[model samples]
Target: MIAKVMRGQDTLGLLRYLYGPGRANEHTDPHLVAAWRALGVPDPGRDPDADLSVLARRLDRFVRPEVRRHVWHCAVRVAPTDRPLTDTEWDHVARKIAAAGGVAPLGDDRGCRWVALRHDGAESHHIHLLATLARQDDTNPDIHNDALRLRDACRALEDALGLRPTSASNNTSAPSPTRGETEKAHRQGLDRPSRAVLERLARRAAVASRTEQEFLDAVRSTGALVRLRETGQGGPAAGYALALPGDTAPDGGPVWFSGTALAPDLSLPRVRDRFAGAPAAPAPLPAAGPWGQAATAVGELSEHWDGAGQGVRAAGAAALGDVLTAAAVAAPSHVRQVLQGADRDWSHAGRPPVGTARAAVAVRMREAARALSAAAPKGQAPVGELAVRQALQALAGAAEQVTAWYRSCSWEPQERSARLAAEALRAAVGGDGAQPTLNFTM
Candidate 1:
């Protein structure tokens, strides 16, 4: 499996992404340190100067096409498989990167500092890249000359190595998007935004809670003329939103982003309703049935959730549990209990930044457990032993990642580290239970 590690504010997010819902310093692992040195990018997380302010300036200059806020950042590490890479393969990979115009600034390294590094992990040999959105040459520098050459070389290299090309072939047409061409296309195929759109533009936009659900609900409420419905689960898991008449193309009609070429969950009808420019009624509150009632409801859904009602029931219970938990935690001492609830019981012996992450994980775990328990019928099993094994394996992974988040923390990443630890703990807990018990009797 290929994994992408996206980071924001440099050291601020690597832990959470790698380990799970936690903070981490750049020097999370010794191998990673060697990897960074091998790559040649400044290991800022280890250095004293790499504070939030330094990150602020860097992000402003890098990822933010808009005004930089809170070090908005992302990085993707592409490693295809877990086979041990021979020297020849590693060199070939390095050569391919160099051939692509991304050269290493540092000398005598296993991988180029600027381009990529092959990481040694359980799954595969993957490339770790820490990059900003900054372009090397903004002035349309000889696109035909350098770019064409780079693409051709890359294609040749991939073919030689028995690897698949990102696109079909080098003979494919070039990407020439002139502004004039876009305008012409607009004129040819379009009508103006409907009159309904004009009135619905927010007279005043109000920002709501930064909490994920609140933010998602806010976006969902936007009755765009075009919209994608949440599938499987709700919130982010339900997937991305495309508010047509809003998130839609400026010229009008459906316009999904990058790879969403197929029909999305957001239906055209839903978009039209939102085009009226009013918030939809909130999703109904979860029915506060008795524990047994809720358990039965959960069981019923889990058993038959697939095909007809897969994520629908799981998501509903998850969201309902969240509302209940959040409502219950506001009282005195409730916060501290969350911290103690999952303290240093695991190998690491310290709670992940047990504050912000606790609730988030709780909601997810309870939902999943309920779904699993509910899914297994009294006699008939829709899922097999393999499926249970797979689920457990996945859960183990989530737990490990959460542990990694805490393990990776360093002094420089103090705040972010704390935050990540908390989040990871929450996710691990949310994945299953805080005080999980393992029995060898089986």
Candidate 2:
């Protein structure tokens, strides 16, 4: 579900386009679902024969008393689903629009006016809403952050309606375009105003590129200025920021957006995952050792995990335990015993404790959880995969929390132990045979 809010004046022109005949809504005759009239005005109550123009004109009067941009317009486009929406579902969506857009007053007799129209068009079915910002009492509902508010509303609706997921809709970090920015872009005839076009291009490049350098190059090719962010004590680039060279400020400084700020999918972490499992260039295979065996075992588990979905709920813990035991068989006797014990602890409580042996246990547990997640298969039964992924994530999160505790402890030996344990675990997990990071790629 995508909800776009555009605030402007000229309520009647929008009404004609929505209620009147046009290519965008020509096929959507009898489209008006519900109309909320200002208090003292007559209620239409889902009346198909209601004069939209008259209602619109009447609605406009309340806003006319206010000098601000009094017209509030929004379009809610639901992606195509396997099942068509019933009339009740359409009505529910209209309710969602009202509630989300603030057209529905907080109290009775607020006199706010609004109308919802369901449009079935060639491309997709959607709802168009036009509302008077000012209520019958000559006051306005707070619509200052309306675009972001509507986006959040759509996210809630997706979960409520069991609709398909969208990354941008789910993203909370991205700053949404304000009504003024949207209106300005429309006036200039820009297909996507503000950072939208740049965001789209960056996502495409991130998906197509094979390495960090390659991704940066691809973004640059689109005429975007790229800035790589370094991490690991200046070891390598770990993140990025991109900006359009053409979009600049008064002092000639280019406007920048972190990859994540543009869109969630274009975020550094997700984009890096796109090229996982396959490196930018050929690399040497890992040695045939215990870590290698563990990697191979995880890879096998990935293949079987999908088929086990039907029985996972009842048997998942036991199955993961079995896989963990098998994977650790080739390790040194002490390491194998540690791995087995960790798996048992995880199975029983889903988390291990931070104690004297916190370093040894937490590091291994974190790596194991990461390995399992990286090795999980993709491309089928997304809901099941998500369930499994959540389980793996819990294990990883628990370990990180425990590790943090160990680091903050008073004892010097414990902290040193943790650092050593972490280094050792990283070596074991980072070997070419595991390529743990690569496993998370789509």
TM-score, each model? 0.23, 0.43
Clashes of each: 34, 1
Model 1: residues with Cα > 4 Å off, grouped in runs: 1-11, 14-82, 86-118, 135-155, 160-442
Which portions of model 2 show Cα errors greater than 4 Å? 21-27, 37-52, 64-68, 80-84, 167-442
Kindly list the per-residue Cα lDDT of model 2 for residues 252-356, writing each as its tens digit: 897677877775446787566445443444333334322343344344434344343322211222223333433233233334444444442322211112211
What is candidate 1's local distance difference test score? 0.31
Candidate 2 at residue 146, lDDT? 68
Number of the top-ranking candidate, with lDDT as the measure: 2
lDDT of 1 by residue, 1-442 (tens): 1122232544335322432311222222211222313333333434544343443343234233552332212221222312355545655554444434332223423222232333343322333443333333321112123344445554555445533222323221111222232233334443322221211221001111223344345444655332344555654343343334433355775553211221111223212211222223322223321222323333343343333232333233222322222212221232224322222122121112222222322333333333332222322423233332233233234334333443454311122223333453344334454443321111
